[model samples]
Target: MNKLTLLLFWLMPICLYCQEDYDFDALLDSTSVLSEQGAYEQCFQILGDLRQYLRENPDKEKLFFLNIHEAYDYTRFGYYSKAECLFKESIQLAKELGDKWNEAYAWYGLGYVTQDKVLSNSSLPPSEEGKRAFFEAIELLKAEGDSAFLVDAYDAQGYAFFLEGKFSEAIEYGEMALELCLKLNDCESEPNILSNLSEYYLAIDDFSTGKKHLQASLKWIKEHPGEIADEIAYNVYRNQADILIHEGKIAEGEQLAMKVLEYAMEHKDPYLLRETNKMLIDYAAARGDYEKAFQLQQTFMSQLDSLHEMQLVLSHDRNQTLLNIGLRDKEYQLLGAKLYSQRVITWSAVGLIVLLLGLLSTVFILNRQSKQFNAKLKKEVERQTKELRISNEALERFAYVASHDLRTPLRNVISFIGLIQRRLKNHNDADLNSFIQYAKDYANHMNRLLNDILDYSKMGERRLVATPTGIDLNQIMEKVFPMVKDDFREKQGILEVGLLPTVYGDETSLIRLFQNLLENAITYNDKETPLVAVQLHSVANGHAVFCVSDNGIGIDHAYHEKVFEMFTRLHNMEQYPGTGLGLAICKRIVNDMGGEIWMDSSEGAGTSVFFTLPLIEVEHEQQSQENGAKAAMAVA
Candidate 1:
């Protein structure tokens, strides 16, 4: 999987919102129906109803399911805080019920939301929380002998990694998710994973594959039109159009976008309508079709007016719900008070009863105080979330600028190098070998720049798949080491491998990851005889830990994290024959695999790098040694 796949998967339909005034089944049916009819007002109205109903009746099994649906609703309406709250609440419920399937679903909900947040901000929030939630859910399912949702857990884990700009890891988990989906013949899951994988391809401008998966999704959606509503179809077409436009199919993309917008207007989906207008304006303007762009803007202004009108309707509906809740509460309180007064007077056993009531009231007041305190905590979380989003946006913009502007020079260098190579062919001097190598180095540098852009651009915009395979890191290294043996020998480096174990992730990404890490160790060495050691050890809960330690110029503590940033090199390119992208790509790969990357060194001592891959990504067939027994019988 790649960035394009991740991006598309980031918008995968890991969501379902419950509907209003209706029963659970009714809400589901109505929401589906309204959406099919393109009646977004009615569709969302049903969602609001379901939200209120679930809030009022948390005891219902339907309400438990509503937890997922409510999150979707809140998210669709741009209430990220509320959406996050709903996911947390549902996860809490799943934890209490010890329900593995639902728990995994909840974790996916978190991943889906986090993925969106990342796209909007240009980076994912810290993923530890998401990974922990997924692993915990996987544990529950495993204990209960329910591996049905194992793929979902892995999928979420992969997504958690992907958001942190871990494309390699994202691909690993995403593949797992895809494999599981295929095994289960889960059409719904298939498209999602495929879409996510497509995002990774897009990240590398592998648009052909991106378009392939997106088209696959569209095809499946058409075949099983019942699975998704018109809203989803609307989104599918709009997204496809964007890709087509970006990939140079301007006319087709424009037609698709316009058609979707037309459909939205037909169905009264004002939000989509508004967004389509903006896209049209930009699309037309970029094509120098100023008249068309101006016309589209005017059309959009009309839609805006329509949207305002629809908003009033929605507001009225919301106010009505609040009024109903208040009225019901007030009525209940009055009736209870009357009953209490009568009981006190009639029973005349009042003194003791009244004393008890007073005690109860006092306790209740304290509880309310605690609830208020909790509310304050929620507010704080919201504030932090907002701040993080703002910071992420800044980072994303900077990354975009850095990628384009930085690549511009590297591209020129590449072009110039080609020119030089062509010119030098006519004059084969004694330094021909060196010149050829220089050209090769320049091409490699350009490739590094492109990879760096993919790394930076990947943060917060891709979905991950986690598919466990029978991987032997030992064997993998055996193969990889031979390829790099000459390099190590040339650098006079003593490379060693520690006890290796099999781990799960995307094969290509992992190979690239290790290859890059090894290259990094060899490329910038202060040691006369550079020493590189690679090891993989099994960790508790089925994780395989990988470490690559090197006897090289140690990095400062302050620059440890910065070193992993794309194009961020402490030393000059002249001093070190590098594009300053190796470490950054390394960090991204580790992160995408649901792992962390950090350094341990004293500026002069060698640097040790360690990363962990959790057991949740493993298949039941080849569980880690310690976890094998636990999974064997359960799988059996």
Candidate 2:
């Protein structure tokens, strides 16, 4: 048995332990059901009772995470500092007990309360400290041979990276998390990973990729469709609505958003209700229905104000920042008096007067400055920052458009030159033969450059002439595999094919994504087994995940971000034998097609590149794919 089970066994009476502690188990189940049914206060009461009972004769080490969960309940009710202190105590207890999983959980709990997971906090250094806790958790799980928990740690690290705005590395660790979870058939881990992947894609403006994950999430919902909790389905609709709005289909999006509000009301989940109302404000505004938006915004503000008023009383001691500022001068002067006892009376009177005057002065100055000088300073900074952001966005737009527009004539010039070279290569003259080779070589070189730019442009200027259709993406890979069969044969590398599912996507982009990733795998090998694997499947969100993995001369982590940029290559042209834009084109097309392109590699062990495509799983596409597959099978 693991430590958790053993600890539970020790906690219960022998008779009760043998019978499985049914009351405790029932309490947990009841709490889950109540929370899912949107009875937060009832669930909160149950949790409190359980924690209180457990704490009365607490097994300090075993109860460490119990308190952590107790703190989670507190945080859900807006008691953030109490939650933070409880989590910190749990972390210390977990460390002393050598329980890394609980330690990691504690760090995650604190982070969640801080809005470090939900909001941008550039003021804080990237929370590498939390990452270290997770790393420790993974190492412990690995030692225990618990791959599932190890996967959770990997995900935790990825979340930390995401919080820090390190998208590429975030994907890398996230990919590792998925790899481990997939191996273990860890069904519970799927929705969480898919949610993160959706967030990542949306950040990069890869709408399809984001939709893909949400799509997979729908299937996961289908897996236990009846047992599905209200919150799960509600989140699915809400996230889909958010994506649809971003994709500029606001009417459809608003309908979906309304569904979320309706669900929240039916369940009476104040938290979900608050979130939905907040979302409705944006959705209503987008629909150019300002009246509804304003109303929703007012409701949201009222909710916050009420909560703030309650918190002011229930959470007085929770403001550590305020307390620290209050206590510092008093503590300093007290220490000074203690060190200089001979002058205590003189120092005491002087300190008292100075402290009173200083307090009044600070209060007055702070109130005055905050109202005027601070507002002006804040406005100026915000204006400058807004201007910079606009300038940056304009530059990115110009680059994308210019690259796209230049590709057409450039493609014609290169194609004509190719024809010229083909004609000249047939000449019989000996001196002309040498000349033909030179012309052919230079033409091909120049053609590669223009082709790279054109392909990259095609990716950036993505306007799907046709929407995605479902394909057995793995079968598509089989077709691509044959084209590169000769290269594999020449290199004597082993290719591994994992279970692949049918995916919906633009065939052209899918083909290019596969081709480039596979090419990278094949070309950059030390030629051992030179193993390459083509893995594909459905993920929780409406996405088809595909990966091309290789055991090769892997890339360093620093270059991972650089690798996606156009013409970014670790090896020189002569050494690598091609334009670096191949991977960049792959990255662009994958991103443009509403997907992500990311790499996972160290210096030598292996590299696995993962990308997701929009799944064809909306209302009507299922029938279309089935008919297409049946007809193709008949032809075969």
What are the C-alpha RMSDs, in order, of all predicted structures?
A: 23.5, 30.6
Local distance difference test values of all predictions, in order:
0.63, 0.62
lDDT of 1 by residue, 113-203 (tens): 7656554442335355544666676666667665456766666667667656788887788777777777777546565566666665555
Error of 1 at 394 (Å): 24
**Which stretches of model 2 miss by more than 4 angstroms?**
1-60, 63-73, 98-132, 160-170, 226-232, 246-249, 262-636
Global Cα lDDT for candidate 2: 0.62
Q: Count the backbone clashes (under 3 Å) in each candidate.
A: 31, 15
Model 1: CA > 4 A from native = 1-106, 109-174, 195-200, 242-252, 264-320, 323-327, 333-636
TM-score of model number 2: 0.36
* Candidate 2 local lDDT, 409-441, one digit each (tens): 657756775676678676777765564454445
